[model samples]
Target: MSPLLAADEPSNLPDLEILRAEVGSAWSAYQDTKYTRATRLIPGILADAQRAVRSYEGDAQLQAKALLAMAYQGAAMVLTKIGEADLAWMAADRGLGAAQESGDRVVTGSLFRSVAHCLLSNGRLTAARDLVTDSAGYLEDGLPDASPTYVSVYGTLFLVGAVAAARLDDRATVRAFLAEADAAAQRLGQDANHMWTAFGPTNAAIHRISAAMELGDVQVAADQGPRVDSSTLPLERRVRHTLEVARAYSAQNRTDEALALVLDAEELAPEQVRYHFISRHLVTAWVRQQKGKPSHQLAGVAQRLRIVG
Candidate 1:
């Protein structure tokens, strides 16, 4: 944990604003790409914080802590989404540490929420539940009334809880969590619109469709999935949506249709080899195996998908 204050004394809030601006710039560079150049910006971000900590111009303690807390949360998310569990856990631990030092209830609540989410991604349901439960007081204490970040924290709580329940096969609990997530998603609406591709209606729709599928509500998935407007989706995200539809087709036992769509997705974005399309191939391969035609083209696709994974 780093110091929140500097040797110099604060004279005005303008310097605080500049620090915030610098932080945004750093984050933007980090988001545009993750290659070597993008990775190189991290030191500048940390150094900027160090400079702010030493520059006496505002509520340095709160400012420094807040910036660190945000950084930790953002880094954790990047780690989680790309299937990098080790780095995500480390970043989350750092976030928790920073939040504790900063003593910002909202930030603390957000940190715990993030930790709970990473646990959910790793399929550690019990751990996720405990952390979110522990975080409730901080969430309620801060009363995430008008803050978009606060609303997002609760959204993650509900969504991750639903995922946990799904893992445990707790249909009733899963339904409950989905309800809560839908409510939270509604609360997040336009208030929490960030340029990042992480949260928003698209995410909420994915969850809604996935939940509907697990619940054996295919019509719901069909109806809800189409509402995710392509106009609102970025190219990479649009590819994800295609995969979801393919999954929906599989759940409906439409193997041929699923294969056609999966082929289209693979064609549209070949770099997405690590995603769930491998499982799709395995499923179709099994279908062929059952049909006593393991040598078929469908079976070949399954083998290729496994190799891709």
Candidate 2:
């Protein structure tokens, strides 16, 4: 085992419910865009989850493994956001192992998404798409009697697959993936955070905007991005959608609109804007394009993103 996953010295077993709550709290911090807090909470969560897994048996052990999988998933996500691609991959791999052991198909599917995300971060676009495809296919066989969690994870896989296809400039594949996601969302019937996947109709629409942006369909992105209501989604998803629309506006040279949207995103989640490569890249480009001193708003955002420093 990697030192990162090494079991701690034997100690009192953690309460399963408490350990689960801690894992949920870490995910909450992450979705709130409290990256530093989430990062701080994860290692402890993982250690406790590991301890719980070691101390439990039968169903309890399985449940502990599920929590361990979730904790690792959270770690992978935060690490990915902060540019720790290698560590993110490790966390994702570990999460997958735990999920398989837990026999939780939803957790397993979700971990597949995490691994695909790590692949995407590493620029392995085809690998990411193939992983999503294979995993979603395996999970699809359960759709006849799928629970909400299963549907959510299954749908979300296609959403990420859409992104991978978009990045590869495979418009047909992107469309196919998005269509699958939309169908799943429609079956789901409403917005939900099932298994921490904000997979629903609105979220599917947001992914459409993301896919459009990735495929360089600036017109499609610009036209649809701002119109979607992401208020019902998680704070993280809402802020990310705002950033995508801001990027669309920027692409159209609607500088004032783009700047306004970015500032709006900053208001929603300052840390998200500060940590996001897209926001930083946009601010950097805007600063460089200015003939003289940039506007106060732009300058302020630049400073917050540390692009001016």
Best by TM-score: 2
lDDT of 1 by residue, 1-309 (tens): 232433443453226566566556544543432323323544455455555544533457666866766666666755564567777787788878877877676677667767886897787877786565556545755544546666666555666566566656667777776676567667777423342324555666666676666566777776677677644544445566666777777667676776676667666654443334334553554565464555364555566565422
Best by lDDT: 2
Stretches off by above 4 angstroms in model 2 are 1-11
Question: Residues 49-162, candidate 2, lDDT per residue (tens digit)?
Answer: 887888889999999999999999999998988888999999999999999999998899999999999999999999999999999888988999999889999999999999
- Candidate lDDT scores, in order, read 0.60, 0.91
Runs of candidate 1 exceeding 4 Å displacement: 1-40, 43-58, 188-191, 194-202, 213-223, 230-240, 253-309
Q: lDDT (0-100) at residue 24 of candidate 2? A: 91
Number of clashes recorded per candidate: 1, 0
Displacement of the residue 18 alpha carbon in candidate 2, Å = 1.0
Report the C-alpha displacement of residue 64, candidate 1, in angstroms: 1.7
True lDDT of residue 161, candidate 2? 94
